[model samples]
Target: MTEQKRPPRAIGASGLSCFPIGLGCASLSGSYGPSDDDNALRVLHEARARGVTMFDTSDKYGNGHNEELLARAFGNARNSVLIASKFGNMAGKDGKVADNNPETIKAFCEASLERLKSDCIDLYYIHRIDPAVAIEDTIGAMSRLVEQGKVRALGICEVNPTTLRRAHKVHPIAAIQSEYSILYRAEAEDVLQTTRELGVAFVAYAPLGRGLLTGAVQPGSLGDKDERLRHPRFSAENLPKNLELAQAVQQVATERGCTAGQVSLAWLLAQGEDIIPIPGTKTLSRLVENIEAASIILSDAEIGFIASSIPPDAAAGLRYRAEHMKNMYL
Candidate 1:
């Protein structure tokens, strides 16, 4: 695949710009399967060479191994890249899934900075909203990071419009990360509306539906140890029906003269400039394919057809398991 020549996309009003497509570094730390350190470094370097400035990871990913990996890849040329890492998802002393205590936020930032080996994080996000904590208190603490120059911008993941509005008032949230794809559009479209109203950018994670829209991962094809196996979207009853939705993408790809993954990404790029998709990959070829997707502009008619092919709720299963659903989109 060839490199794209598009201009950088801005992250809200934070004065930060990056390639339209960023690299989500979760898989590098074994989110899906085992990974090699040297091979992961090659992929990161190749992404940088292809103009992907934004590298997204989380402290909970591989227990901070992901951040340390980025530190090794871009420690010498930090200015050339945008490091977007998250906190609040890792379990704290109480054994909870989220930890958004104001006092802990600063300590989390310190630990992430140490792992990343960087002076300041380009974009710091609350990986998950803690229902027990007020959004204002969380954002208020994050704002102080901006004041102290420890973080350049703030973001939140799996946020709803009301929580997003409340958080924005406490501190300007530059972005919101969430699972957004053609198969799952209900919440993300609602989010786009609020983000447009507030000037907050949408960082789309799992833009490919965790590979359902990629056309490569078929029903029952995932390895036993793959984390995606735990997601309800890939369940025994759901995978077949979901793959059927992906077939729609394959049809569009055929008409567009590109791969299914490229067509899926191109349709997303056509949504709006404020939406940025971070599709993670462990392969060099896929990194190039995703970067090239930024340049494939679909006609309005094609975009509409793709959207209609897979309706908002066409997805077969929940975004996550029943036990974990309560914590998402809070």
Candidate 2:
């Protein structure tokens, strides 16, 4: 397969430039649906073949299975890839999420390094901000990892401007990861403004609206085994309304002769060069399609039309469940 190479984008000013689109590895853990190790490894290797150097994973994903999969896929080619992993979000015996304390930073870093089979991580993010612990203390401990050369740069996910400022003050944040896409933007855009102000790069996860904007998922099509079924946006009542937004995306894709997913990603690429999106996939074809999105340049008018098509409130339901939503943008 011929892979298209696009211009690189920076991760803050940390001096790391990767392909415009990074590969999200959450699906490898079957979070979206069941996927085998073979296909997961294939997707990672294929991503590398296509010049996709950035691979985003977290220790919590598949309970460390995702990181191990990445290690297997990039064994000898580790130096050629940029691995971004996260800490925080500890799983209790009952599978409940817990707060991240400053004392555990070293242990988390060591565990992640061992799981990834890498001496250092390119970008390490705090998966979610812990409300109980001061952001300064968590960031202070993370800075120590950078000082020890265990992590090249630091990042945070689902953070608000206030939290971002507090964390950055403790240590310069190289990037901020958040759920950003046409279907969902109000909160992510708010966070984007702060990151741009601080010259921190923004990494957009779920850039395809969690597969809703891909023009493939229909109302109630997500199986019971899929994790998205728990999401309000994919509920029966909300699915129809959310799929309408996909229709608008499809219209633009038809006009541009591209897939709806590509149109969605293209619209994001037009947002800014500093914004890098990691659209995940369990299939090589979908991975290629997402990478090819980098080449679909949208005109100014088209961009405006796309933006107008999916307003911030166009989609129905919250991005996550009530309990999980509390941890975002804090």
Candidate 3:
């Protein structure tokens, strides 16, 4: 919809590249709320048609329905684009968020490859770290996948500097996927410093602050099945405060002649060439708006103004709920 677009961004030194903003496919599997399979396929097809080169997914999304959806949508064209999926991030009966067992890595990759219907995955990641397992052991297992030619590159999600360094020692980590946006850069900035030093690309998920920066998700508009209802950032107590802070983006959008979501995404793009924002949407118009965000180039002054408008620690609530917060950034 926009008249401008940026060049392809590289993923570390992995010899792979993608469009500036990619598609985050979690919502397609009904992570946020209820999703229709027919519409989900349409959205994936539209994203590919609109030049979204990267499609981020996880084995945990809809119990692996998401990968199947991608396979069905792309079919013969699956290899043309990048599909970055993850494993061991599912919640167990104990309510923990990881299962990075070295023993099961092969089985997971084999199953993911089967579900993806692809001979080799463009990128693979550890959805989350299992504290009980040694980082070296898990990464070492992943590195073997590369040796066997099953994966093109490796990545880690929700990682810290120390853990990243350890993982890199085992293998060259091409990218780091984390929550990043104007409203939630405290962790992203900290991780960016290390990623830049290590020459690792940063894949930013939740670039729109879980739709808060879009100025459309009202307080009571979330469906009963929506997962945001359980997030602290979307709590009845914290939602208003966070939305108030997000108004700064809306003001900038008004001045810049674009949607608030565009400003939010453009601000992320302004962060650096290594940063790629993957904002997701089930609606076609919103998807187009996200893709067009790559075209927006903010001035130096505007970028600074937007950053100061929402301080690093100004957000009122935690990224995840109290229980899940314990496992992030490890």
Candidate 4:
């Protein structure tokens, strides 16, 4: 097992501590493109060897393939890594996200535990808000899982202040997972103030802007199967403009002698200690690059410079399509 070289950062008041940077694991399930199972397992083991102690997954990722992948990769090493999985968003046969109901929350939690081959989940997140069900009802059922010892900590993803306040009243929220990157910031930055006030750790998913900030993906270069192709920022018209923002990140990376992805991750790290970034990769080299980003120190001026280069709302497209965006930040 890889030993932790630095002190762990705590998440909210749940007493859960992990390396500030984590492996998001979405790519392992082929969210980006096709993935080889053996190679994905190798990447997971390599992440452990390199001190990435937190692994984030969701039931909706490849319809539980990602969770099962985590189970197979970790094996006996499960205890050494923090397993964070989510529920609430169900994918239908039509490939559309269904409503989040209490029944689904309980049933999904049970199914997730079975797939993970673990008795308890370290961190369980409600992947997205279900407008059909009250936040209180959903969180109330989640609190029961905590009481039953099935889940150690509770978290909610992509929720606004009102929902956070309501959910916290039912159970202490350990963290808030959202698409927070320098590339997409308005809503998440506003949510950060509330999470910080409530002492909830902000888990920044896609902290690398779904690979655009890494200066790797270019307009018209993504594979057809790549999920990013469905995102607005990656659209043909917006992609050219988004690449300009990526160029700004790349320029800084060149000046600092680091990868553009590292510069983006470093910028997120500089936001606050309470913020933790989970940048995903299906390869070991990119995993190590993301893990090493924690050491890239940025001064206040550099942070401001990067911000100016890619101002808030500068990215031309929405983070998700209209149908998908409706479920986020509720």
Candidate 5:
């Protein structure tokens, strides 16, 4: 079979560039559920075959298993694709702690490179901010990676506008990865403005709302082992309320003759050229569904409806539990 061609697009604030839509590999290694190596590799290969040239993964995901899976899947294509990996969330001395110390940052980058089987990472992100360490100190360490040719660019995940600016002051932040979807418009309305003002690209993770907006996840649809089951938005008490919000999205999507997922992603793409959504899935059908969203455009009226339909805090429950929520927006 002939290989599928990748789409031409720029990535990062520097326009140091890559594919517009990246494949978020978190699911391949089973953050959501169990996945075999063979199945995971097939998904990666299929994504590449479909022209996905940007792959995003993190060390904490599957406890480094995800990176190893990517290395094995993209052995030869490793250089062809822009590999974006993250660090700073690995277990620390306390066993289940997060650390972003300069020493830890450097060590983590080295380990990620070894696992990815690459000489240099296309884009490296700090998975989560460690409150104990100053943002500048963390970013300063990351900047050194760029100078050492270990990382091509630097990014941060789940950071606030102030943190973004602080990090940018230390080094040019190429991108910011955060939870953004039709159901989660709080960031788009405000955080997006900050990223735009600073010329930093926003990488939207969970752009499908952990399958909520995709019309695939109904209350009790997720397996008990799934981590999302514990998420406030997906908990038993909030699931019905959240589903109601998704149903409203479905109505709008029906009017537009597109899947709810497509409407959600298209709305994000329309938010800004600097915005990129990395919605992950293990199934080929779902992967294709997500990629098509890039082409789904919304008229001004349609965009307004979507925006108003799901207000920033429209969904029931907090995005994450209190413990995890404490780690975000830092």
Candidate 6:
């Protein structure tokens, strides 16, 4: 078999060069279940060895345990990789709260730096915009971190075009992290355009649709403790309908002689050069499969066909329930 070639380069807004494919660390912190720290460390090491330079994590993940885990995994090699962690989504008295107060941002960055065992974070995001606080105020705090040499660049997660524009005025956003996949194209078609116009990189989280596009999640695959089980799209009624979309992905994968996950990721990479898909997985084999997608190039016609097969609204159920959805795209 012939070895497939990887895609061309995409530069982040901060001028940091990275592989078009990134490794999201959400699943590594036990999003699905109790994750084996040793196995997670091995996966992170394996991904770095495979040329994946961008690593995405969050302070809220495992309540800071994830950052500590990355510290152990990267150790001295931390400088070789770009660590992207988020702030603002801290749990508080009112349950989960979005806080971008200058004090909170400073405290979060310091804590994250300590947890990651790094002197500076490569890409630091606000995580979510605190609706109560102005976007400029939040970004102003992030900008200070850049001036202080504690953060390399700024990023915002799940913000719309308007919020992005407002935030950019305060600081040049190096990247905008959002949920983008064949299963979710609403933002890619619109918000992504704005990011492109602003010279900001689009970091796609859950690029494989939280394991749905992988063809590995069947009905009742998630445990009761799994947060995905409570998501509307993964609910019993919507599971069958969503599985139909996965079937279409499977058919396309069969034609390409690759896993459905690979086909889905390949299609995302084909979207544009500025888009980087960070698909998360705990297993080494799955991580390898996700990375190999970077080399699976699809022709224009193939990309169009896949897009038509799974239109933005084709998937069943809302991406998130009302409460959770409200927290996003602010």
TM-score of 2: 0.97
Question: Candidate 5: lDDT of 51?
Answer: 76
TM-scores for every candidate against the unseen true structure = 0.98, 0.97, 0.97, 0.96, 0.95, 0.97
Q: Rate the local accuracy (lDDT) of all candidates.
A: 0.91, 0.89, 0.91, 0.88, 0.83, 0.87
Model 1 residue 167 CA deviation in Å: 1.0
lDDT of 6 by residue, 23-102 (tens): 99977888877789999999999999999999899998999999999899999898889899999887777775888887
lDDT of 4 at 101: 76
- The residue-by-residue lDDT of candidate 5 on 109-137, one tens digit each, is 88999998888998899888889999999
For candidate 1, write residues 181-266 as lDDT tens digits: 89988999988899999999999899989988988887778887799999988988999899988888898788767888888888
Off by over 4 Å in 1: 1-4
In model 5, the runs with Cα more than 4 Å from the true position are: 1-9
lDDT of 4 by residue, 65-156 (tens): 99999999887988999999999677656565645677767789999999999988999999878787888988888998999999999998
Model 3, position 97: C-alpha lDDT score: 64
Model 4 regions lying over 4 Å from their true place:
1-6, 92-98
Error of 2 at 166 (Å): 1.2
Candidate rank order under TM-score? 1, 3, 6, 2, 4, 5
Error of 4 at 157 (Å): 0.9
When 5 and 6 are scored with TM-score, the better candidate is: 6
Winner on TM-score (2 vs 5): 2
Q: For residue 24, what is the lDDT in candidate 6? A: 94
Instruction: List candidate 2 stretches off by more than 4 Å.
Output: 1-5, 93-96
Model 3 accuracy (lDDT, Cα)? 0.91
